[model samples]
Target: MGSTSPPATAKCSSDWFAHKKKNGRISRCPIWGDIGEKQNAVDFEHSFLRAMRASNIEKKDFILEFQLYLTHGSPANDWYIAAAAAASDWDAFAAAFWVKFPAPKVQVRMPMEYEWILTELRLDEAKLLEHHPDTNNYMWKCNEQANWKDFTNTIKAVKKQEIEEGVEHQKLLEKTKAEVAAVQKGLWECIPPMPETPSKALGHSLAGMGFADNSRGRYGRDQRGGYAGRGNYRGRGGGPGQRNSTPLTSEKVATLAWNVALLPHHPNTSEGLQAYWEQLAAWAGRWGREAVINHEKPVLLKPGMSPVASGECFNCGMRGHQGQFCEAMGDQTLGFREREWRVLCGHNLPHSSGHSAQVNNVLDDDFDTWLSGGLGKGEGSTD
Candidate 1:
C-alpha cells in the first residue's frame, strides 16, 4: 500500500498548493484588498491612514477605525466613514498626517506653511509627544490668522527705495551730459581760425618763376653768409665785439650775446643790423654796471669769394643795375621798389622776376646806409 503512488509526484502537488495559499493572503483582507494585496501590519496601517486623510474623514470615525486596527490588527468595515470624519478638505490633512506619522509619501504632500507651525511650537515631533504637547494647538491658531501684511509692507518699502535710486541715477546722467556740452563749447570758442588760401594770381606768378615750391626757392648756401663753414651751432646767437677779438671780456661778450640772440634770424639790410646793435649797446651798458655777467661771443659772418654783383633791372627795363640804382640814377618809372624790397627780405611776394632788381637795390642801399650810420658816424640807424 505504501508503494501505491510515486514519491516525486506527491511532493510536487503539496508544494504547489502551499505557494497558492501564500500568494492569496493580501487579497483575503477587506481593507487592503480594495487597492491591492495587503503587505504587512505596518504597510496596511500606512495605506489605510493615507486613504482616510485624503478623503478628509471625520475625527470621530477615524479614531474608531484607528482603534480597531491598533487593537485587532485589522481594518474595520466602512473605513471611508472614518476618513470623512477626520477633515473637511483632504488636502489639509496632508500636513497634519505628516506631523503624526511622518512617512515619506505624507511628507511630500505636506504644505510648506507647516514650517511656521514647527517654528512657533519649537517642537520636533519625532523626539516624543511629551516634548511637543502644544504643537497641535499652535498649528490651529496659525491656520486661523494666516494674513501676510508685515511681509507685504517690507516688500513695498524696498520697491520705493529702488524707484528713488533710479531717479537719482537719471539726474546724474543729465548733469554729466550738460557739463560735457559746456566744455566742448568753450573749446570751440578758444580755437583759432584757419589761415586763408593764397591768391591764384600770386601762385601762378610764383610757379612761372620757378619759386612756387618751397624746395626750389630755398637758399642752399646760407644767404646771410654768417654761419658758413661753421659746425652745428645750438643755443643763442652772439653780439658785436663779443667774438674772439682784442679787448673783449667774457662778461661783456655774454651781455651782448643775450641781446643779439633775441634778434631775427636774417636782417635784410645794414639798418636792420644797426637796430639790433643799438638794442645790444643798451644791454651792454646795463650789464657792465651790474654784478659779474658771463659774456658769450658773437658768431662771425663767413666771407664767400663770390663778388657781390647786381642783376638786370626790372624797374628801368635795363639789363645791368637794380631798381634802387635806377631810382638813384633818376628813374621814377620803377614804382614797385618797396614791394621788391619786401621780397628780397624773404617776405612772400606775388611777382618774382618782375621785382628782383628793385628788391636787391633796396637791400644794398639800406645796408650801406646802416653801415655808414653805425660804424662811421656813431649814430645808430634803423632801416
Candidate 2:
C-alpha cells in the first residue's frame, strides 16, 4: 500500500502530464488513463516508480531509463536532467527531482447547471450507507483532479453562477436537508400502532352481533343484555352499548369474517398492519382465522414469469388465490369440478349420460358402412 520510491536522480517521463503515444496513437498509462490538469508530477513519479519496480528494474537502470523520457525546452526539464547526472545516490536524485518538479495545483471548470451540485458534489447519506460506486468515483475524481482549496473555490463560483441563472440551489439544499432529517427521525422513533382501521371496525361490529367472547366481559354488552344487569334477554339496556339478544347465524359470521380479512387500506407498515389483522382475527374466532390464512399468502404475478395454465380467479377479486379458482356463477358457488363441466360440455348437464350419443353404436361396422356408402367395405371384395 505504501508508494514505491524511485532514485532521486531519475526524471519523470516528458509526457507525464500529457498522455503518451504508441505508434503515433495516444496510449493510456497502465494505472491511470488520460492524464489532464487533474494529474500532477508527483502522481506520475509514484506511478512510474511502482511500474518500474514491478518490472524488476534496478535503481541505476530505472534512473537511466526515466532520464530518456524527460520533456525538453523547459527550465524545470533542464534542472531534472542535470540533477540526475550529478546525483550520488537514488535518495539524493529523488529529492532533487521532487524539489525541481513538485506537483502543480490545478482548478476544474464547473458545469453551468447547479443541479449537478446536489447530484455529484453534495453528500448523500443513503448513498454513503449503501457504499455506492458512483459516490466513490465522484469523491476520487474530485480529490485526484483538484485539491481541496481549488475545489472549494470552484463550488463557491458554481453557487454564484447558479443564483445568477435562477437555478435555486439554496431551495434544493433546504429540501434535501428536510428529507434527511425526516428519514433520520423515522429511523430513531418507535413506530406507533395505526388508528382503528375499517377492518377493525367491521370486526367489532361482527363481534357485537352476538359472538360470545369467553375471554372478555360479554362483547357488546356491559356484562348484561337487560335491566339490572341480568335475567331479561331484551330491555332498556339493549342499546349501542348493550349486547344483542339475537345471535348471528353461521352464514352471516362467515361472510363478515371474509369482509374483514379482505379490507383494503390496511396500514402500509408491516408491523402495524400485522397487529391489526391478528387482533381482528382473534375477535372473529375460527372463521376469522380461516380468512387470515386464505388472504395472507397471495400469488405474486410479475413480468417474465413462466406462463401458467390456470390460477386464482381475478374476476372474484380475491387474494392469495387466482381467477381460475373462482367459485362465483350467477348466485351459485361453483367448484373446480363443476366449472370443468361447463368448459368441456358447454353447459352444466344433469348427468354425463345426457350427451344422447352412443359411442358403441358409432363404432359398429354397420354404422361405418352406412356412413361410407360401403366404399372399400370388405378387403376381399373389389366392389
Clashes of each: 13, 13
Candidate 2: where are CA atoms >4 Å away?
1-39, 74-76, 104-383
Residues 196-294 of candidate 2 have per-residue lDDT tens digits of 785654433232222123311133234343323222212111111222234345565455345433533334366554654454433333233223322
The RMSD (Cα, Å) of candidate 2 is 26.7
Candidate 1 lDDT (Cα, whole model)?
0.36
> After superposition, which runs of candidate 1 have C-alpha atoms over 4 Å from their true positions?
1-158, 199-383
RMSD of each: 33.6, 26.7
The top-ranked prediction according to lDDT is: 2
lDDT of each: 0.36, 0.39
Error of 2 at 119 (Å): 11
Q: Largest TM-score belongs to which candidate?
A: 2
In candidate 1, residue 39 scores what lDDT? 37
- For model 2 the local lDDT of residue 287 reads 38
